[model samples]
Structures are given as C-alpha cells and as structure tokens.
Target: MTSAQKPLHSAFGPQTTAQEALAGRDLRGKVAIVTGGHGGIGLETTRVLSNAGATVIVGARDINKAQDKLSTMKNVEVIHLDLADPKSIDQFAADILKSNRALDILINNAGVANPPVIKDARGFDTHFATNHLGHFQLTARLWEALIKSGNSRVITLSSISHMLGPIDLSDLNFTKRPYDKDISYGESKTACSLFAVELDKRGKEHGIRAFAVNPGAILTGLTRHLTDEELAAWGVRRGENSEFISPEGFKSAEQGAATSIWCAVSPLLEGKGGVYCENCDIAAIVPADSKLMTGVREWAIDQTAAEMLWTVSEDLLHIGSIPGLSK
Candidate 1:
C-alpha cells in the first residue's frame, strides 16, 4: 500500500472550516478521541465533531481548563493527558480502554511548536516526544479498541515545516547536536508524517487507516513560543500595534481543523491511507527545488524512513514486544 500523493480534487479548499467539512454529515453513535481538543483548532475540531453527534473525548494536559472549555458541550468528555509524560499517557489509555468503547477516530492533534530546547525525562527531544513519540505509544496501546471499530481513522497533525528539516535518526534526542528550535520542530513534524505512513500500512489489515495533515499556517496557541517580533517576521503580524493579525496564507482555527475533519469522515478517502493531505485532499509530490511549501517532501513520506522510525519509536518507548506492532 504505497502512498499516492496526488490531489483528489476535493470540494473543500483552503478556506473550508471544520464545520463546513462536516456540514451535512451525521456522526451519531461514533466515538472520537481528539488530543489537545480544548485549545485552538483542536477546540474547533471538538465542537464540530460533537455538533455532528459524535461522542468526543477531549484529551488535555490541563483537566480544569479542558472542563471549563468543554463542559457545556453535549457528548463531550474531558480526560487528563500530558503527552510529554509517559505515565499520564498510560493512565489515559487505560481509562479509555476500560470504558469498553470502540474508537472510530483518533486525532493526534496536540503539539508544541518552536519551544525552548528541552528534553523529556527519557532524554528525548521535547517536540519529538510530545508530537510523535507520545502518539506512537498511545496508538499502540489503543490498538485493540481501534481494531474493534471495524473501520477507524487516525489523523496526525503535521505541518509544512516538515519540509525544512532533515531526520537525523542517529541523534533524534539532539544529544550530540546543537539544538535549533525550528529544525527540531520540523523534524518532529516529519516524524508525524512518517508515522502515519507506516502505521497505516501496518494497521490496514485490522481496518485502521492513518493520514498526515498540514493544517496550514493558523494563528493558534501552538505559536506561544514565538515572540511578537518573530510573528512579524513570519508575516503573521505587522506594524507596532502588537495585535495578532492573520497574514495572507493564514487560516482561522476552524479552517485549520478542516483537513483533520475531512480525513476523519469523508467518503472520498475510503480505502485510502498513508497519504499526506492539505486543503482536504491528497497533495501533489513536489520537487526539491519546487519553492512551494504546499506538498509533502519525499523524506516525510518515504516508506523506508517510516519503517525505520517505527522501529526506533518502539525501541525508545520499550514497547517493541507489543502484539502485532513489533518489526
């Protein structure tokens, strides 16, 4: 099942919001778990899914905050989940499994972008740990519920930044290299894209499919690390007003969540998996010198790299022996 990184001429485009993507769909009786669902585009994603009648579980690092944001929503539940902490992830997975609910959609939407150089307790780069490794462990632990659903989709939020960094498997933890925030962030996103590729291939037998999404340049909490000056440099803001502004290609939170929602419920993607999507459709494969940031890079979707990443992730997490996931 190789990736066919080509557009499907989807009805939705750069301007479609999450609500628009699910406008006519009824998700009654479905169960979805959206990580970081209390903030930014994740919040919009939660609203749209719940509005469509799906029972949505909002996984958050801040339980109180999540409750405050989501308590009013019908069919929405908040659970404690800190992606950087292994114990938190394990407990969250245990609680979900104990509920005996089949998981229909798993959106690995939580992530940190361009934060200060830091490492997890395990010494893994913080961005990599939270963005890629955490979801890796969670998906593996939730494998049973996902398989039970008969058909399930996992959407991982990658970014166009994935085009800016190289995956250095030998020093994924940045132990021997000088850490650059942008490069580290890009590497983590690349891991995210690759994770979808390999996971889809491995899980397809059990009716699980996965996709990597470039949600576009949305002004969200994910940019918390960036200063006003940095935002201006990125064209997300301008002048001395210091008020946040959306640049030319920037998307609102609702629009940012569109591709994830589309990947989750759109019939157009049935039997399609392991592809990188943007603007609600599979993206074209661009050349190295293409000068465009819209499509996925070859390294991000490379099967060999995906396989290697899966193996490395298993070894790092010490879950290599997990049934059906070991290399």
Candidate 2:
C-alpha cells in the first residue's frame, strides 16, 4: 500500500535524506545536543542542524574523534560524554550548566548493539546501562538546561527491535534469565521509547516536549557487532551482489537521520509530544493483530509501563529525582 493509504502514520521512508527532510526549514538560533554525533546517523544529525544555522554540540565518548569531526563545522562544540559512565555524565552536565546555555534539543542516539554479556564498572547490564539508563541519567542531569530553553525538544532513538522483546523489570540485569545479549538490546530499546513517553507526559507543561524515533535499518556503527554472515542471515544486504529488497526495508545513514531532523525543527509537529516516530513523521499506532513491520508497539507505548520503568530506572540509578526534571 502507498504511505497515504496505510493506517499507521506514514513517514518519508528509509531512503529520505536529512537535507530532504529539512528542506526550506530554518533554525538559526536553536541549539541541539546530539549524542554519538561523531558517527552514523548522529553525525548526519549534527551536520544537518549545523548547516541549518543551529549551534550543535557533538557529544562523544572519544574526545579526539569528536574534536576532529566537529572542527570543520561552525557553531559546533565537541564535548566528552560517555553515557555508560555516570561520573562522565555528571561532568558533562556540570560543564554545560556552568556555561549557562539553554539546551534547545537533545537527541539521545548513542547505543550499543548485541555484545557478549558484559557490565559497566557498576555491574549494570551493558545494553540497559548504555542504551537506557545512561541516557536517562544524562537527560536528568540536563533537565534544568532543557527546561530553561523554552520550546525545547528531547528525542530518544528507539528501534523496530523493540517488537522483538519487552522490558524485563523483574530481572533487569538478566541475572535470572538466559544471558542472551540480543534480547537484552531489544529490551533496552523498548525502555528508551517508554522513557520518552513518560518524559513528555510530565514535562510538557514546561514547554519541553519528548519523543522517540525509530531510524529504520541503517548501516552504522551500531550494527558493528553483527558479522557479515549474521547480517546476511538477518536479511540485510550490503554489497552490490545482494538481492533486491522491497521499498519497505532498509536505508542509508543519511536517510536514517531524516526523522530526527524533522522532529527537531518541523512546524508540522508543533505542540505534539510523547509519540514514537519514524521516517520523518509521527508513527501510527500498531494494531494488536497487525503484521505490519512499521509503527510503535502497544507495550512500548503503554503509559503504565512507561511510568513503572521510570520509577524502576530511578531506583537502579540510586537517584530519587532527575536533577532538574519534575512533574
């Protein structure tokens, strides 16, 4: 079916480039903070925002890489931020707060793929810690700046992988369940979507809107964990010799970054919040029995689930409240 005929919300497709999405849009005075801005869709996001005249801060774990990549861009600042490290998050927040600049946009895009079971220095699962909790803490720490910047937007990068699993709050670390890292990654992405829902529900009164984006299959560092054979088995084609895929599947990194740019600056989404988006548009709700590979899942967008996960996440991080974030 054509996108207009589809029941679920339609977007520009996985092949739409960032420039195409932001065509004719102007965001000269805006400031955007993007994690993983040195590579993948994150890098494209940074480039697009900067080109549109926004002051883009490139958050990277690797200082040298961030500096090198952002050096050529005007009004771009590269800051060291390792989402997996709480201390690093705190430092990044503190530095930004000291500078006293309001944060206009935050794209929680840094993530890890399926890796062997490993924990951070604090013994949290690598996927949950990096993909969800780390961004959670970072957002919380930057809550003040986000609030201070009127009309601020926070976008979390979720994925279709969320449909593969649900959050396992009972044993969030996978200590009781089998140590399947892929499942853990899926669960973490689910948490990312839910978190955005809760954030928007609570923070909208302050002009801070929250959203989650599913950047359809893009060849980026996030997929580095999968080998060539695994990628082929997963129905992903890389080389020129690959089989022809339908229009519904896969995209380049620039195309993957499109929705984020749209959400960040589009007048079309004014006053909207708490929705999962893909392909430069708000995602349509998924039907319970539908087999469509697009749109947000019910469980991932559940209100109760989102609130429950928020509480659980705070408990695990040992923080009673998100720094400057309050209902």
Best by TM-score: 1
TM-score of 2: 0.91
Please list the residue runs of candidate 2 whose C-alpha ends up more than 4 Å from where it truly belongs after superposition: 1-11, 237-248, 288-290, 322-324
Model 2 residue 291 CA deviation (Å) reads 3.9
The true-versus-predicted C-alpha distance at residue 216 of model 2, in Å, is 0.3
TM-scores of the candidates in the order shown: 0.96, 0.91
For candidate 2, write residues 1-327 as lDDT tens digits.
112212234346667899988886787888889999989899999999999899988779999988887788888898899988889998988988998989999999899998654777788899999999999999898888998998899999999888876788898887897877778888899999999888988888888988889998777777767766777775765657643332346687789999998888777777787888888887777765566768777878888889999989888888655544653
lDDT of 2 at 136: 93
For model 1, what is the alpha-carbon lDDT of residue 67? 96
Pairs clashing within candidate 2: 9-284
Candidate 2 deviation (Cα RMSD):
3.9
- Of the candidates shown, which would achieve the greatest lDDT relative to the real structure? 1
Candidate 1 lDDT score at position 159: 94
lDDT of 2 at 113: 90
Residue-wise lDDT of candidate 1 within 275-310, one digit each (tens)? 999999998887756679698778889999999999
